[model samples]
Target: MSGESAKGQKSYTNALLRLENITKAFGNTKVLNGVSLTVGAGEFLTLLGSSGCGKTTTLRIIAGLERPDSGRVFLEERDITYSEPNKRDVNTVFQNYALFPHMNVESNVGYSLRIRSVNKVEIKQRVADALRLTRMDEYAKRMPTELSGGQMQRVAIARAIINRPKLLLLDEPLGALDLQLRRRMQIELKRLQRELGIAFIYITHDQEEALNMSDRIAVIRGGLLEQTGGAAEIYDAPRTSYVARFVGSANILRGVSALSSLLPNEIIAVRGENIVMEPYSEQSRGLKGVVTDKRFAGGMLRISARLNQSGAEVVSSRHGIDSPLTPGQSVSVSWDAASEIVVKDNDTGEVS
Candidate 1:
């Protein structure tokens, strides 16, 4: 949800990390062009997009793993564009976990302290504390080979948090896990992050994961950032056609906004779940539609229909009802007038 009131409050912008006019190129092809974004302190931010969209590159720039051709980076109001990875007060947990197979969990967790010449007593205490935070203390003596997938992730997180970095960068850290494990880890990760109070910059192509875990998400496409906002704001109030279609399943239809008073003049919108399929003559103020098809989708029944009055296609689903809805049923689909979002031409799918 947006951290502001409706009636269009001013957008919040107290950035913790700022990227100004960042540009990157591989030979002649530009990977990132004047890309800019800011991450708020203690907020879980997810940089989301398909491959080749520069989200990974942007994460790399923050980690000091990749240098940008142009622009400056500021972390906590301090310029750190040219700072080495070792000097930056941050830790990166990559998709691969990047843990050393040769090292035990405790050594891997305490490596940074050990390299800094921290006394053995201090390193032991810190590593033990970090392991306890991830609930991996029992696995401290085990090698990376002996740990389960979830246990390995915990170890990796333990390693990253051991040093108490000011920021944490997660690039598809949960991509490899099975569905059950990923779901479990996501909950654990979110809890741990909230407890630690360190800002997180996460990267992922999974929109659901981004929405589920992040305070806000940045959607990028073709090396350009399309939009950034909280999960509800972005999902319920998409700013672009790509965002609408990508974030969820949507039926895009073209119509004259001026002609249809009921249909949302806005771009693509999946039919809201709250819309009642049954018709009422007195209070029928929604889009005039006809039921075209309905199908059982696991626990819920999905209904696809077309607007008879406006000729627009609509896709909706009904859940929790054991009775089945018939096909080609007559229904006047309706939506709240105030809930209809107005998107720009570029943001809305083109008429063509």
Candidate 2:
């Protein structure tokens, strides 16, 4: 699902937006520290992380809603670090939708044009085009109060895109919808982006959302970019323990427990999907373990094991196929050596 290879072929000069060493702080607390990133033209790049991790703050900085303490922002090679929001060629879609309750869909979609003193005839045509692009043309006469959450979202998008901005910043715009609705919107949003051929800087804490919709995802932590790559690259080869655990469920084996002389002092990160629970055999390539816990987790059977070599606990999961695994059972845990991700200890500056 990663578009990294496709995006890698392009040159940096073609980036639609660039953030250089962006830093921001609220009083004594630093919210963003030297964050830098780039979004290619028509690419869907997601800023993915937990709350207060600076994803939203970064998006606001790019939108000109919040200025950074230091750093520069470029749009189409033009430095707009201090440009007014209105003058920038960008639009933002927030989580709240922020539509005018008193206005109908057409009026709301054409609000920007109206504020610019555009002719009524031209505004009407643009509004119609925007509404049609979002497939909400039939609901043009409906008020915000009467429209469903999805419909309201469509209307908001129509309004944001009516200006045909160079870049669109979506700040958790789908966070308010139900799970099913949110999933549907994810697909619709991606399709719309491809059709519009405009770059999107989407912000979300949901890993699934980021993987599902992003061409590339930037994982932020402590006001800095922790890792950035396609979903597969980030998942299969996380640069740090934090990213491996945060991006998905992982079983980390450290020190002597990892049983890897190549990185004897480092922590080995193995994803749950990569670990397999099987009967003991001389040909088995991983650590010997004893099953300590087992549970049915939706579609997979999650098994927890304590490694015999170092007594460290590790988790593995298998698809439901009537496995005989049970608590107190002796089982071997094995995985491909290529799947073990080496992560360093940031505090100690050690490989572990």
Candidate 3:
């Protein structure tokens, strides 16, 4: 399970790749449990989850870096679960820009081509084409040490793409960069994937990255697939309590459903955000609470209010809102029932 395979080439499959019920374990720890997903041709799918949640294990399974204990994988409908890493039409770009310091940029990119016994002319052509696509053509003769983190990472990407793999696996490809560079690379990676027309299975713990880049997101929790949906679907209608708090800045509140409110309690979660906080309107049907804290972030004012019954504090940030009072101020907090996301834990039966 922990060994390297010799570099070799195989006939390229026309289909991208598909993973079905892939499960993996290490020692006594179960990493991936019954994970099933598909990466269509020319698509970008992201595996988003927190640390130790099996995102990385799933990526490794796709890359042929780790063999699943059960399930199967297919490229173009051809079974390849036992296929060698180099034989599969896939490549992975590690988080730590895996570039060779001794090798120049061109060598790094063309290394796989060399292993495949590609002719010198074809290798040179592919190296030039890949480098040009990543905007690193001029640095062909430069060594890995000669480039910055972002630049070297581009070299890593160029190296992966040069192989002309049908599927590209990116494990936090932009994780090493600073915030600004990471944002820039996110745009760059998306654009590059579009231009390549190849399937991308991206893995990351960052939800924002998943929202921004993925055509579809597969959320994993506790080694299980929680939910898979588009950005709007998962953010707006989270299937579980864990999902709502994980995807965005969620403000979970407690409220007993008033049946005659002209709206379903299910839709109450959406109405909580639009609740008017200005001078507490009398028409608002909300829990009375004390405002415990306030934070001014840029153009938005965040208010943390504690409910009277359970003393559970719900946070709401109002845009272009400035409060007239200080912290620990006494205020009757109210929110339209329509704006709240009514989440109930199945085990505890407590509304989140």
Candidate 4:
């Protein structure tokens, strides 16, 4: 279990875990449907989806918390499909810090080692090392109630990694924190993963979270893998309408005559930021639309307009906070041909 395998497949020759055609069901509802995934050594891969979309179930299978009805789980060329959780070289950090309320930080972090009958001297050294890695060494004696959300999370991580597991699974580990704190923890987690050189399998339903931390993201929908790629690839060239619509704010144009040369019934998607909005003029080029609504976001002004020809709502974004647009005002919306992507169609819709 501690050795590497040369049989690792695909673009990664050093994958730490592989699940082939994993299937699971509860009663009659199939939670996971032949889902296959691979985590490269020291790579940050996120399983992203909404609730009951099989993301959590997938993570549980990898951690041996839940057994897949069918499929093979491999770790370093060895089949661990039916292996007990304790026998696997993996650890899981759940959203609920799950820290023992009665235990101090140091005790909580060293509990695993103590349970295994590790020598007290070695336990102390490993606990200190894990705490230092997570930057929680200074708070080693603090009680769980005395620590903030982020601090408690660090302690939880320290406990999980104290054994130096080959792979770490995180199930929405930041779901409980506020937005600002969550963002900060996201950075901290990514940095820790890089510093430890341990493969991280993170799970989250938040698109921004996955995009922010993952080296690659696997988007799951309705118990199926929707798309898997880097943040930019998944955003810029989504293979399906669901991915385009779910991953970001997209304006799906279906048979919008104002947009030229569109195939019949073809559904094209354009990111809000990609659409250029300008004041309407007699000679203004591009598709014509009437501004229906405008709102101010963090760094951009989001505008919603109704296409004159197709009556379809198209959203566009303007940088900064200056907006002269009012409801019922006319405007021109256009984007570069290269920026437009075909996501889906009613019949024979193509993706490129």
Residues 1-352 of candidate 4 have per-residue lDDT tens digits of 3322322212355667888999999999999998988888777898888788899999889889999999999987789999999999999997798999999999999998998999999999999999998889999889999999989999999999888788999989999899999998899998788777778899998888988988889998778888899888988888777778777767777655424455445577888888888888989887889999988876768889998978878888754677778879988888887777887553222221
Candidate 3 stretches greater than 4 Å from native: 1-15, 254-272, 275-284, 296-299, 342-352
Task: Give the residue spans of candidate 4 off by over 4 A.
Answer: 1-11, 257-266, 345-352
What TM-score does each of the candidates earn?
A: 0.81, 0.88, 0.85, 0.90
Model 1, span 1-352: residue lDDT tens: 2222222222335566899889999899899987788876677888888788888888899999989999999987799998998989889997788889899999999999998999999999999899999999898899999988788888888898777677899989998899888988899888888777677889888888999998888888777888888988888888766777666544444562432244243553443464456652557666667677777775677776688766876777654545344666667665544545445434434331
**Cand. 3 Cα-lDDT:** 0.75
Residues 333-352 of candidate 2 have per-residue lDDT tens digits of 88877777787544222221
Give the 10-residue window scoring lowest on summed lDDT in candidate 1: 1-10
Q: What is the alpha-carbon lDDT for the whole of candidate 4?
A: 0.83
Candidate 2 is scored at a TM of: 0.88
Candidate 4 lands at a TM-score of 0.90
Model 1 alpha-carbon miss at residue 102, Å: 1.4
Error of 4 at 184 (Å): 1.6
- lDDT, each prediction: 0.76, 0.84, 0.75, 0.83
The ten-residue window of minimal lDDT in model 2 covers 1-10
Q: Positional deviation of 12 in candidate 1, in angstroms? A: 8.7
